[model samples]
Target: MPEGLIVKALSGYYYVQNSEGGQPVQCRGRGIFKNRGESPLVGDRVLFSETENGEGTVEEILPRFSELIRPQIANADLAVLVFSVVRPELNLLLLDKFLVHTEHARMNALLVFTKMDRIPDDEEGESIRRVVEDARALYSSIGYEVILTSAHEGEGMDKLRQALAGHINMLAGQSGVGKSSLVNALVPGLTLATNEISTKLGRGKHTTRHVELIPLAGGGYMADTPGFSQLDFAELGIDEIGSCFREFRERASTCKFRGCTHTHEPHCAVLQAKEQGEISESRYSHYVGFMTEWKETKRRY
Candidate 1:
């Protein structure tokens, strides 16, 4: 028996990298896994039996520290949410959803603003500054790190790499925000397919179809995922959603109610901040919208 980490899953095959064995072992789970109703996911650490055929059967799946439903991976160090400044514009609703989802998984969220070169600084600097500042104050206030990146003119690649240098990060964003391009830049010859953003639709074609971990040059690895338009938030209840907004949490604690939903609560600290312009109205609006959507969506189930 040996222990290994499930690094990749493809074509009904699981690739496990065994440290003790010093090699990747292609393996499948035994009937015990099926009987116990356990299926392995990428980034999962497991115990297995090494077979003579250079493969093995997974016997046990170690408890996952965190799990993300969108990419369906476990034990991620962080999630990089990439979005473009122009082209498709920023989707606040989707961005909030991703943030909440990442927090629910107990993974740190890194906001990456990509395609900055496309939106020239001369034309979009002030606007971009406001957006970056608002995002920084909004997310950073919630304990997340927000980074600016540009794959076109290579603006923030070094900073982005520095952030991901020692962490196992998962890259996500709306399709065509250059998630793949960033990955290509980070890994160089890895060359993940990148597509042109459609002028008519203002979105990029899906270049990555499935999640794959690419090992970085110095250390660490990154998981590349397909572009997504919507994410599931019904699993995250409204009461626990506030802490996900780092900026709002401190002010939120001052709300009149112990479990204030920040909507319609008397003397709500969160709403007070919104009115005082301490928190961006745009972000607060998105929070309310997310709660409303979640409530409606949950009622059906």
Candidate 2:
């Protein structure tokens, strides 16, 4: 019996790193897990029993600060949302969903726009850069950081490295968006599997089927997560939605009502921002869509 941390869990095996570990000790939980409704997840600190033969058994799971249902990781510091500017194209809707989920999980959201090399022409590249800058501003206004990247060309690699320097980052995005490629670029020699975008669908094939945390060269962990077509917003309530969109908070406070949904609410500052060309229409639309769906789901539940 010894103390350790669960670094990775897959199939039915858990990799536990002991307090005096030379290497991570692989262990399986006792059958008690099934009865107690407990499943060990990554980032979980646990007590384990070590056999003389170098095997181990998970004895108990420690408390967690937060848990993400999709990737099923615990105590994540940040969520890196990766997307390409062209190929599959950027889905602002999905981006918002990831940001909301990150906030709900109590983790910071970092936007990483990949594949900048594809943006042709000095003029065209500048245009694309402007779009990214605008997006950066939009998220930054709401207290999130956004960075541009090209896993192939190595653009912004330094900044990306610095940004991910100390945090436990979970890399999340749709399939074929180069999440794995970015990981390989960040920590050379860690060639995680990567797939090309489908020509027929103009999208990426979902390659990463599970989540695994890779230690960076400097000093941090980057989680390579599975890709998905959609996220379940029903898990979040209407009240929890507004705070995720940080830009809205400042103006939302000025709304006439105490608890403004910002949809059909009289004298809403968010609407005014859209009218005044202050907030990007795309983000406002995302907020409205999410707010509407959350309210509907709440009613149904």
Candidate 3:
């Protein structure tokens, strides 16, 4: 069977990039996938056949090692969490929430802080600067790769490119945080739409409409999808959420009890670390918030 990767899907068409590397085949998925309630996604490895007509048809979707739900891609090697340090401003709580999902999914996360040139030098920018510095220290300490970049000024572009080299990277972040701009910078001549931030609304309109995996010059591929502001944790469980927080998971073994919720428990290693300033209170607070929300969800069930 001829094998290829579904690089882009649009309007019931799958553009499969074959290993032989000619033009991407505009293929339709086999009808059986619909009956099986499975759809071929960008980044999916597929077995396809050429029809009597010119186009091809996807016959089977091979098994995926990992799948991301938000933008919905299969076999993504890296999750590039892009965020702006200015404009819409940095949201640590949201970043931590994103980290939880990435951790749970077992996807290697690369934190790309964008728009560094937008950071102001005045007194008003003090807090923002502090937040960026702190976040770099905090997340880097937790074993994540952090790259600060300004796509406009070309700052850290080489570092960012080096980090993304030879891997299937999927970009995720809020709109206007420079996901498209970064992609444009990284991949020359490939212009991804980027909108100016609405000064009134403090957010950018969605510029990316669909998911399409673009092959990079550096022996890898990248998918830029619609940026989003919020995520649903409905797929996660209360107990499983603990292990998703890297710091909490690290201290889980030393807790007074197995499966410690880390909320008001005596001799809790996590709580103790939080009090001692080992764990960032900001991160711990969000973890507790997730726990509270999930608890309410469990009650309703």
What's the lDDT for all of these models? 0.80, 0.82, 0.90
Q: Where in model 3 is the C-alpha error above 4 Å? A: 299-301
lDDT tens digits, residue span 1-301, model 2:
5777677788888998776757888898989988989888887778998878887899898888878889888877888999888787766788988888887887888889988888878896788778767777777776777788888889989999999987778889888888888999998888788877789999877777777777787777888888878887788877678867777767888988887877778798877877898877888888888978877877888
Q: Kindly give the number of clashing pairs for every candidate.
A: 4, 1, 0
Better of 2 and 3 by lDDT: 3
lDDT of 2: 0.82
Candidate 3 residue 39 C-alpha distance from true site, Å: 1.5
Instruction: Give residue 298's lDDT in candidate 1 (0 to 100).
Output: 92
Query: Total backbone clashes of model 2?
Result: 1
The candidate scoring highest on TM-score is 3
Enumerate residue pairs that collide in model 1.
Answer: 141-246, 141-247, 142-246, 142-247
Give lDDT for model 3: 0.90
Clashes of 3: 0
**TM-score for predicted model 2 compared with the true structure:** 0.91
Superposition error at 92 for model 2 (Å): 1.7
TM-score of each: 0.90, 0.91, 0.96
List the candidate numbers ranked by TM-score, top first: 3, 2, 1
Span of ten consecutive residues with least summed lDDT in model 2: 1-10
